[model samples]
Target: MSVFSRFFPQAQVSLVHCEENQVILTAKNDKTAESEKRQIRLIDLAREATPATCNLNPLLFNGHLQTGWTTIKETTEIPIYYKRKIFEQEIPALAGQFAVDFVVPAYPKTTDPEATDEARKYTLPSGLPARTTFFSKEELAALPSNDTKPMLVALHGLTGGSHEVYLRAALAPLVLDETAGWEACVVNGRGCAQMKLSTPLLFNARATWDVRQVIKWLRKTFPNRPLFGIGFSLGANILVNYLGEEGENCLLNAAVICANPWNLDVTNIALRSTWLGAEVYSAHMAVSLVNLFNQHVDELTHHPRLNVDDMKDVKYIHEFDRAVQCALWGYPTEGAYHRDASSTDSLLAIRIPFLAINAEDDPISVKQAIPYDEFKQTPYGVLLTTSWGGHLGWFELGGCRWFTKPAANFLNLIAKTIDLSVTPMPEKDKEGLYGETLANGSIHKPSHPSVFYPVNRKLSMTIDN
Candidate 1:
């Protein structure tokens, strides 16, 4: 003990030492030769530790380090754990499940270059007041004739409005990718009162019709280009359902659906509330429809969608379900509608390469409720589940970025599957997230641990009935 205790007192001196010349070499600076040597050693160690499949491209890294594309498609070995979140179906509507995913970002999260009113709305569909929004996309706009680019349709989630354009702006990030080659159009569900929607979301499932309308409109206007659809939550379900239900009527060749629920019935049962989920969704729809009715209530009592009388003292979802969804969509009851409107059950027969990603534990998108057996069997559709993405809220736990890699990778996977060329999530954004809600109606939720019911659980949810 005394022989080794001279200058190296309390030190083993055997593991990390050299007895050659008694000279010590210490790293002097971050970019010093020693530091660079250590960096190379660390890089080599990292490479040695990496899995066989994780192909780290030194060339790409060098390029990025030189050109600032640090967030490009860097390969990682983190295996995919399918996340699936399930939400109960709307009462009086079908039962289902919805999930959230970390799909890649094809759009730039910045102010979109195409967001400008490049042209103008010169005509109104169905002679409506050109109500600025609705539950899904509409093919009513004339595509920019002078320019020939693909169309990117975006659908907003529940309680959303044109008043706050951030949701739409977040999506702007997806379409901004130069390789995607598509223009974006944000959809306002007819159920909200804020965007001046043309109708009521009472026809929740029928929202697919509106999305199809938009696609059809785009095809007519842009005849030569391809159309892609991207929808969040309800919008996703609506678009997927339309593509599934319409089969060949859909003009879309590809689509990305995030944080969606299928099997309306199962989803309704998976919520934190008894029927509060359905009640909340339905009540919001009722109020929006009621507001629209109120706008012309005295003049159009016979329009036959939803009326001032049916909403009479309606409280729970089942009650409102009987009045609104049933009365509007021609269902005998909400129970019947729930059976007919489930999108999960309708996943088969979809000819397009549709991608559905959701979290396994989303409060709204219940995962176990999805018909996985069928999803796995579908050749035209793909279901990629994540472990923790919440509702379309896939932001990394503390940071904001959530949907970039997942979406980009999914798009790339599909491109490979379908033989198309494209890039991964935008290399420009290292910050940001993707997500949803429906029309304005009477619903409003600001941000946070989005508590579902009591209209105000610690004050996260709010809807004036």
Candidate 2:
């Protein structure tokens, strides 16, 4: 059947060489001018870039099928190998100071599976706990080998956190494995991952300060081990922006950005273009956003700029941003917020070895938004795109998610290749790409605020000891 033929979609990878702005193509179907490849061959580059074969499930054949199936599928397993410790981080934002959770790994004294059953018993309503074992600060520190492993700091997508099936499926195996010798910390954005946010401010695409704080804290806490970063969807956008903002001053040894909506403007348009995109994906996401807003309605309603009552009418994802993200962050409009928040411009500034993966058929993170030219210019960055794998869903022959294996392999390659002795540039010498004062004394904030709130400058931390 013609439909069955689509089950085995080939990978399409692209990377541009900055000099002369030359474009490189991988797949045979990629349309390029005959003059486009005067000196270089534009064919079959994906096979060399990724090892994973994209044999999509016969049942989940199309983009919408792959996307829908992956979300509802019950393949995500709770992490059972490691203990969890929640650290409360206080960071400054436009609205005020807010405390966010930094869920990290804490090891048990012994590997007796039955002994830690109660610890793993800590469960969420979703039945997939963000973490399995629970430990206090002192309790974690008391363990002999708790603090000496390599670190992987992860960030989840919109309205998602450590509990996300995609994240747990992709990350838990790599970090929780004792033989891998790695630990992970999921930086839960305010009001996400079941954390109750007190401040009116909710996280947006440009919310990188909290991530910066967590990364810096991790560096301070574990000065001896190497550090890596991986961000999914919205988290990927924030992580990339943070990497660009930090530039030479970022402490990450390597990073992975998966299913990143590189350009928010294109993504917004794509969501509203089709019936399925608008009715299903956008509507679903808007409801999730509204639900998150409802959880912190008590705190958010009191803000002078926010009309919490009116937020109930938000129908589209962009409308939700216009009502909430714009009001809280002081954006004049949703367009301005999307423009400032997009990571397209930030890709070229990144100096660390990183892999950027995307699906050509991602319904939400539309392929049109993929900055092919920008990625080509980024020397340390690699972009891998599959012809299938809708959004973050890459179900293979036996329902296996394909992206995780390649991601882990890429991170491992980076760990082996990079020099660990090198450290980030000194603070004074480096510059902040966002929320900083320019040389001419003009402050470059994320947006122009119509209403003023006390800017909380203090940074502090409280571990759930």
Candidate 3:
């Protein structure tokens, strides 16, 4: 028997990539790679295959598993599974470290400006500087002057900027699609990735003002385009809070959040309580924050509330947050900052379709910190928990990285659902009546003055007679 027959005997599999011991395989009928096919065949195969074992719920393995997103059943407890080897490498909080050690650094780097067609800077009302890098400008320009496409605005994680690996992964699916007419952009937070901060204040999980400003700008810039938000880690926390704070008034049509630190208090405690968390994760984060602060120390020293002496002893994330984050933001204590900044309590207020994905083995954002009950109760919120993806390190065999495809799929699904062409009808409705055929083969009449009708789901356009 071949590798496919031996391992996945029931399914037709296609090999995507292979290098030495690593082999990437996918379902034969995967839509994303329909045009591409690999010629390699599995020649050396054994009769007996080792049974794969991991903590991932068996329910997740069933079905086609296109994007690896298992719909949350009615149960509150969600089970996540990882391939045995992947699980073994996923040491809570150290998964990323292991990935960096083994995985070749072939992902797009910060120097690749081609990822975005244009870059624009905005100074928030509070004088904090932020930047937006846009994709698919040429495609947008080709459309009619009044026509607009759906836009996805991504926010990077802690100490990450627009050019980070996750942002690139999120952008890869839609940025080059001329037919889909989808546009993407990144919202770089203040003082990240060498960006100069005009104000002394750096963004935290509660700093929704910068994101709000970016959304407002995107709206003003492209008034007709439907907006969607995708945030990772710390950025995901901020997006979740912003959605809850805005409630029904939130401008986003939908959202996808991955590896969010829903409960900062629990996350901070986890980071300090364990050897892996303290030495690997917290140390890395603290160093990045310290470097950023030191680069802007001259300007930060002038801020009335900040005490530079307190920052000297900050060796861990909790200490850093207490000395600088809480102090700069005017929170009396670190506990107060973590409590107030957490998005878990705020999830209930979100009214728009929101998907939050977390890994149970995630070292930094402890699985216990996830608010599954709240997620289940929230009307528009969907939670997907996997057993083994380590803190944004969802790498698979054969060079495939997970998370991005599912995120892109979610974005596309929501983009199709939004009604983009709702226009005012003329006084004589009957005179301008026109029949438009929908995907379901139903005729939609836009003759009525105030009545809404479904148009082609694929194309968000509607006819106003």
Best by lDDT: 2
Poorest stretch of ten by lDDT in candidate 3: 95-104
Runs with alpha carbons beyond 4 Å of true place in candidate 3: 1-145, 417-465
Q: List, residue by residue over 281-354, the lDDT tens digit for candidate 2.
A: 99999999998888778878877899876686799899999999888867888888887789887775565667
Compared with the true structure, what per-residue lDDT tens digits does model 1 show for residues 1-465? 565333222201001111121111122244546335221121122122222221122232221121122123212222211111112223223222221111222332223223212111211222211113211112113223546455566665544432223234344344555566545565555533222222233336435544544556557666766567777766677776666644434467567776676765566555425454455444554564455445544433444566768767775445655776676556777766655666665565454556666656455657666567666444445566644444544432223334444444444333323322221111223111111122211223446454321111111211111
The local distance difference test score of each candidate is 0.43, 0.66, 0.56
Counting clashing residue pairs in each candidate, in order, gives 76, 1, 4
User: Which prediction has more favorable TM-score, 1 or 3?
Assistant: 3
Off by over 4 Å in 2: 1-9, 13-49, 78-134, 143-148, 422-465
Q: How accurate is candidate 3 locally (lDDT)?
A: 0.56
For each candidate, give its TM-score against the true structure. Answer: 0.54, 0.76, 0.62
TM-score of 1: 0.54
Clashing residue pairs in candidate 3 (N, C-alpha, C atoms within 3 angstroms): 56-80, 56-81, 80-387, 93-363
CA lDDT for candidate 1: 0.43
Q: Compute the lDDT of residue 28 as modeled in candidate 1.
A: 23
